[model samples]
Target chain A: MDNEVLNTEPQPTEEVRVVMPLVDILDGDDGVTIYFEVPGANSKTVDIEVKNRIMTISAASSLRRDGLPVVFKRNFRLSDGADIENITAKTQDGVLTLNIPKSERAKVHKIQVQ
Target chain B: MNMLARIRNAEELLPSTLGGLHELFRSMLDQVTDLGPEWLPEGSAAGRALTVETSEKEVTVKLPLPGCESKNIDVEVIGDQLTIHAARTEVKDENDKRHYIRRERSFMDYQESVLLPVKVRGHEAKASYVDGILTVTLPRENPGSPDSHVVKVD
Candidate 1:
């Protein structure tokens, strides 16, 4: 007689960081507005960084059913017109919004008619 | 006269411009197909994302819905399944026809259903939305039921 036992325990694996968040960029007259849909992430877990004309968004999800926690990430290359120093970001309800204002020279100005 | 000429010019430009867009769209589809099923959206909803978790005493469901008001969201538990429906209309400026350099946000309407792993008390389910995450918790009807078991062959 031959009998076999089954391994019921789950094997631990390394964290998978493959998924990227979807984003939308809106170019306005004076600045640019960007929106990102990053579900399962909150303000505390999300990270936004901008340096040398590059912007990176990374976040770790708080909710999980199995395996390693879900991680969302994306990168963007900014144009020279953006004033990176005055950029502002806000996150609410799994959506992140970033406002990048334009420099003085980039703003539109009306000229007087002769 | 120049305005009419510009309009005619735009009409002439349509096919080539749209052809470029069609090529771009096809390339995007190829990229998505290359990434495989893991990159595709989950559940029946086209773009909505959802998660389901099972525990000893309860089962939980979560979804992300940003800019959605509480009044627009609907939750229903029918038989061994859970359904969530939501709609959010984005308000936009009527006069400002700002040229969009990059646009991603829009009004969203979604309906998704998830099957429960085990029998649960659907009537006693509770749901809450916090920071854009909607969480629904339902208590299992029979807590003592074994989730896994081993049988011996005769």
Candidate 2:
């Protein structure tokens, strides 16, 4: 394929009808920043977890769609360089910004001239 | 063997784009997707989602404008049409220019008009923006009629 798909879909489970919130990922020298659009989600209802090198984001919103409860859920596989322990996240204006620091090995190293 | 005309043996798997065929495909795809009708394609431009609810006395419309300032949003109700226009701006300093590797939440501007389900008193519309949801409620011009009435057969 000429264009590779960086995004992914959720696993089919009991909650197959979940609302998969869209996301955008940015790579920086120090870390990776991910923004998720989850309207009506607050800090208390949003949950972020990492297990087995997989990051799972799940949130419940007071907003209802089609008279049913709205649940935002998605998963992303983390690279080895992701410093999961030092990850941080913040929710503002219905958007969740997650920052995962890059490990020492993942940082770019320049060779010095002798 | 000489043939006057060429023939193919495969069935028409996909419908043609002419006429209503394309609309049929779009409706089918819309049904498969669980998202609301107001929501546009993912990661695209400033497409927004708005929900409309109507009752016997009034009609309410709600739009989720995340990360947007209330001052930037304008709601107008004219006749039986409701129009909303808003913008989500990016804060940038002239001295510091931050480069983004991937940006899905860039500065966006949106404007859309929707027809109200019932005649509304546009002048009596009340709008409030809170928690990124802009809600507008308008009193019905004629509240005497209910949405539906159960009639008994003799």
Candidate 3:
């Protein structure tokens, strides 16, 4: 039973590499926002990367002082309407939010009648 | 036929677009080592997994509550049971009209209770939420007692 409990711990070990962070993707008139749940991550330890319409969020959890570190990773596919060059991201209280703005041509706008 | 040889042969037959043998092995490993629902902590019935650590004088409980603010959380202890309740509210900006492309996060209500493993002074328990993790520390009712007593769970 002791071994069973130890083996079932949620903390990740050194060999754990592939982790899927829970996420939420939201869209608005101007842009989109994505939220990732990484329980122990802070601004200093999280990394965001985007290339060829693929966005990946990678983070390391360091909350347990005496426990092994846990890592989190999640990927997203950007739509053609998204403006990749103007994307912005922020991390607060273990939640990472990404704001991906839509391209000027894709955003809805009214054209005045001539 | 050797199992390794057969696996390699099967890998060659699979499309290269699917990441070939490397992706296949990684997925197999993930399936074999996946921690199912059974791995959830002893006391939680419907919430996420919780971590419990015991020391000489106190027992500490840690739970993840991402995006949950302290204002919406409540912790209570009753007899040998400890319960956590929280309601999460999504924060939105006033300027923008929002639409959801794929929404996985929103308002969520959580309530979970756990039976204490050892005798504890429930009245003296203290809890705090920090960096999205709720930590509860409960002191032993009779520390240094000759035998540890397990409290009955209702």
Report clashes for each candidate as comma-separated counts.
Answer: 3, 0, 0
User: Scoring only chain A, what TM-score does candidate 3 earn?
Assistant: 0.75
Candidate that beats the other on lDDT, 2 or 3, i.e. the better one:
2
lDDT of 2 by residue, B58-108 (tens): 899888776777899999888999999989765333553433443445447
* Per-residue C-alpha lDDT of model 3 across residues B25-141, encoded as one tens digit per residue: 533221111121222232122123577777778878888787888888998988878899988876565765774444545448988898877778988998987667788999978
Top candidate, metric lDDT: 2
Clashes of 3: 0
Q: What is the lDDT of residue A27 in candidate 3?
A: 60
- Candidate 3 iRMS, in Å? 10.8
Q: Give the per-residue Cα lDDT of candidate 1 at B43.
A: 18
Lowest lDDT 10-mer window, candidate 3 chain B?
A: B29-38
lDDT per residue for candidate 1 within A60-114, as digits (tens), equals 6664434456666655544455677888888877677778787666666779999
What's the lDDT of the predicted structure labeled candidate 2? 0.64
Off by over 4 Å in 2: A1-8, A11-17, B1-48, B91-107, B147-154
Residues A1-114 of candidate 3: C-alpha lDDT, one tens digit per residue: 223423332443566433456666666777777787777777888898866555666787754433444566654545566788888888876688878787776677888999
lDDT tens digits by residue: candidate 1, B75-132: 9999888999988765346665544443445547878888888888999999998766
Off by over 4 Å in 1: A1-13, A16-18, B1-48, B91-96, B104-107, B147-154
Clashing residue pairs found in predicted model 3 = none
In order, the Cα lDDT scores of the candidates are 0.62, 0.64, 0.63
